[model samples]
Target: MRVPDWIDETRISYDAVAGSYADMLRGRLAEEPFQRGILGLFAELVRGGGPVADVGCGSGRITGFLAGVGLEVFGIDLSPVMVEVARRDLPGLRFEVGSMTALDLADGSLGGVLAWFSLIHVPDGEVPGVLAEFRRVLRPGGVVLIGFHAGAGVRHLTEGYGGHPMNVYVHRRSAAQVAGWLGEAGFTVEGELVHRPDPKTEGAFVFARR
Candidate 1:
């Protein structure tokens, strides 16, 4: 299959900074109480349903967190280096190199899918297909939690962690817009939360059920 230019760029960019990115974000859950709480809620909701996949799981940080909360969880990332770092840093959990657009799972297999700040790299045109893939893998009443930078437009990153030169675009979308996409992908909007996580950017969290 031919890889998309953006996916290739994102994979390379993250591979270049995999170790540094892991180090930088290792303790993020400790600082973000709201995010942690939301994750806990997700875990609670999907606990007994079945296994969960953390799509675009970077370094397995959130994957580990979900497991710590008692959910049967695994992780998948586009960058092989990121998967290596995740396996090395977080043992006893499953981490694989894969793409969100083409998950290697059976139909109606997963109970939940978590796209934590990962979909920000996907373009608007591809969002629907990706969400449809999520829906296809999830059983009836399965849930999906998406975290993203809330707003419009894109941010280009020239330099990333450890001063690594990167060619990546961070695409931001509104909660309502993402909710609409989720609905189109056969999901029911459970709730959407928009908050200012920092002075420069607002964050959006959308919970949907398939």
Candidate 2:
């Protein structure tokens, strides 16, 4: 599918299930390995007291956590409903409805960017452009940590979890492929972490500095 259509479909799919997803995955989604990866990501990419945007920031958990760590945080999700729920749930933080392929943030404006599971919905053929947009939004030396499933092939999804319809895609790439894309995205690969997020999910956490 073309990227625009893919993104539109993703937005529609997530809008349908935002509330239920937030509730169902609240405490359940934040596991030890995920936490560990985020912490490691923090050490490698983000430090403190600066601007950051979490693309596909569903529920705003990581965004809020990063804010608590003292970085100025902003989150963007494709689903308006998800953005609304995030705003309602975390009034202290800011949330916007938007596409990851394009952000309203200024060029070379951010300190770091986090895209955990955000790229899963992106078509493999269109990921380079997404990565380029990510690079465009970041400062010259800024960093971005993108986490995605580690494996092979593609997954075109149409389902729902917790009363929310799921429009997801899974594109598993090797470390070398990831590194190559990171470099092409104007980022330098600093580190990587690979672990099974669950029985069904094995993920690679790639830390790249712009």
Candidate 3:
């Protein structure tokens, strides 16, 4: 399927820096275990054994991690280049080029959804709609784990993300605002965590489930 504008969207776009971005983050995050902790939140919230969907999965780091832990995990990103890098690095897994706002899977098809820092570039107005889409693809009792930079300003990241120019890449909002979006999407937040201790993020991490 052709990628959507939103998926193709973001300033520090995921497509351009696909390989280096993955390499950089994988090296930086592997020892930290923050990513593992965040996904673990989903395991705690959801009841199912999970045929999980890792939305906005750039380069499949978290997706591969979930699979390594024995969960059936499939990843989807908006950038073909990003998906390609993921497949190249992790040949045994499934990674597609798609947007979280319009997942290719069937409704209620997932037991859990993971949105890492992938949504960092999403504008505030678009989050509810995206979350609604997240809700649509998830089972009624599915879990959602979204993590991003939380603050009051509209931040746009630069070329470092390895994406396009028109794609405005960085954006963030308060924790309450994110919680509201999840609620609108029919999710019940089970936990909210601020991982500033990680030294890489300035925002909080939120875990919400349907």
Candidate 4:
């Protein structure tokens, strides 16, 4: 099968910025109380159910956090360089090169799936397919947590992460729109948290179950 152009572009962009990106976001999770709270609730809900897959786990920050909270989690990302950075930064954890459009996972093998601010790169037309993959890998009642920029339209990012050249499109979406996609993919919407730290940034977390 032919890979999508956006996937290649996204992967290349992340690969170029992986190291600086890791450096920039490292240890910052401790400062975000709301994000920590959402992740904490997710961990509690899926703890002991089974292993979790942190899909699109750029540099494995969330993966490490979830592991620290006692969930058996592994990281997967579209960029091999990102995976390498994650592995080097968190040597004790497992990280792999993979894509959310087609996760390299077994059906019903996961208790939870996390896509923290990673789905922003996925186009709207491909979201349902990605959500379907999430549902396929998760067991019945398995939980899925997704964080995305909450708004509408796409932003073409030509330069990012310390001025590295990039060819990526960041898609902003509404909570209700994402909830509808989850519903179509067979996930029961569980909760939605919209966070606006400032006028320029509007993010959201939508968690659901299979």
Candidate 5:
């Protein structure tokens, strides 16, 4: 399949900052009580469902956390460098280079899919297709946990993590808009959590079932 220019840009940008991004975010879960709690809830929802896939899993921090919580989990990232970092950092877990828009998993193969702050890289026009892919890879009653910045519009970053020069777009979406998209993609919205982590960004978590 032909990859989009933005996807290529995201992969290259992340590869350039993989190590620094890992270093900055590796222990971040410890500081966010709400996010950790949500992950715990997600693990419980899909505990006996089947194996889970952490899509767009950068450096595997969340993947490792999910594994530590006793859910069978693996990770996939768009950036090969990020996948390498994740593999090196979390040797016990599995990590691979892949895309969320076109996952390489069999239909109805996954019990749950986690997109923690990862879907923000996907442009608005392509978000539905990505959600459809999520629905396709999930079994009946499978759950999907999506974390994103809540609001509207996109922000361009010229430099990120450790002051590295990079090209990336951070898309902020409303919770209601995301819920509608999930519904359109054949997912039943279960619950949503919204919190203002900072003045500049609102964190949103949507839990849905297939």
Candidate 6:
């Protein structure tokens, strides 16, 4: 298969910053009570159903958290360097280099899917396909929890994660828009959470079920 240029760009960008990115974001999740509550709810929803896949799980932060919450979880990321960091940091967990656009998993095999702020880099035209891939891998009634930047339009990021040069487009979207996409992709929109961590940026979490 011919990989998209954006995917290659995203992979390269994240690979360049994997270590710094991991270091910067480490322990940040502990400060977000709401987000932790959300993850807890997701874990409760998928408990005992099957293993969970944390797609685009950079450095396995959420993957490790999910495991702590008592869910059988593994991580997949597009950047090999990120995957390496994840494995190095959390050697007991499973971390693989992969993409959400084409998950390397069997059909109806997952209890849940977590795309935590990971889908923001995916272009709009490709989101539906990615959601479909999520739906394809999930068992009936399996859940999906997606977190993204909440707003309008796209932001082209040139440098980030400890001042490393990057080539990635971050698409900001609304909860309603994401829920509609989930609906169109055969998921039942279960919950929506909008949060403003700072005055300039808004983030959203959309929970749905297949």
Over 4 Å off in model 1, which ranges?
Answer: none
Could you tell me which residue pairs clash in candidate 5? none
Q: Model 4: what TM-score?
A: 0.98
lDDT of model 2 at residue 151? Answer: 79
Off by over 4 Å in 4: none
Higher-scoring candidate on lDDT, 1 or 6: 6
What is the Cα-based lDDT of residue 192 in candidate 2?
A: 82
Clashes of 2: 2
Show where candidate 3 strays beyond 4 Å.
Answer: 1-7, 161-167, 198-201
Worst 10 residues of 6 by lDDT: 194-203
Question: How big is the positional error of residue 196 in model 6, measured in Å on the Cα after superposition?
Answer: 1.7
Q: Write the per-residue lDDT of candidate 2 for residues 1-210, one digit (tens) a residue.
A: 465777778888888888888887776535565665565557445665258888999988778777766778789999899999999989989899888777888998888888977887787778898899889988877888888778789877677765445666667776677878888877889888777756977778788888
Candidate 4 positional error at 26, Å: 0.8
Worst 10-residue lDDT window, candidate 4: 196-205
lDDT of 4 at 203: 90
Q: What's each prediction's TM-score?
A: 0.98, 0.90, 0.87, 0.98, 0.98, 0.98
Q: Cα RMSDs of all predictions?
A: 0.8, 2.4, 2.9, 0.7, 0.9, 0.7
Query: Candidate 5: misplaced stretches above 4 Å?
Result: none
Native-to-model Cα distance after best TM-score fit, residue 73 in candidate 5, in Å: 0.4
lDDT of each: 0.93, 0.79, 0.75, 0.94, 0.94, 0.96
Per-prediction backbone clash count: 0, 2, 8, 0, 0, 0
Q: How far out, in Å, is residue 202 in model 1?
A: 0.8
lDDT of model 2 at position 152 = 84
Q: Tell me the TM-score of model 3.
A: 0.87
Judging by lDDT against the true structure, name the best candidate.
6
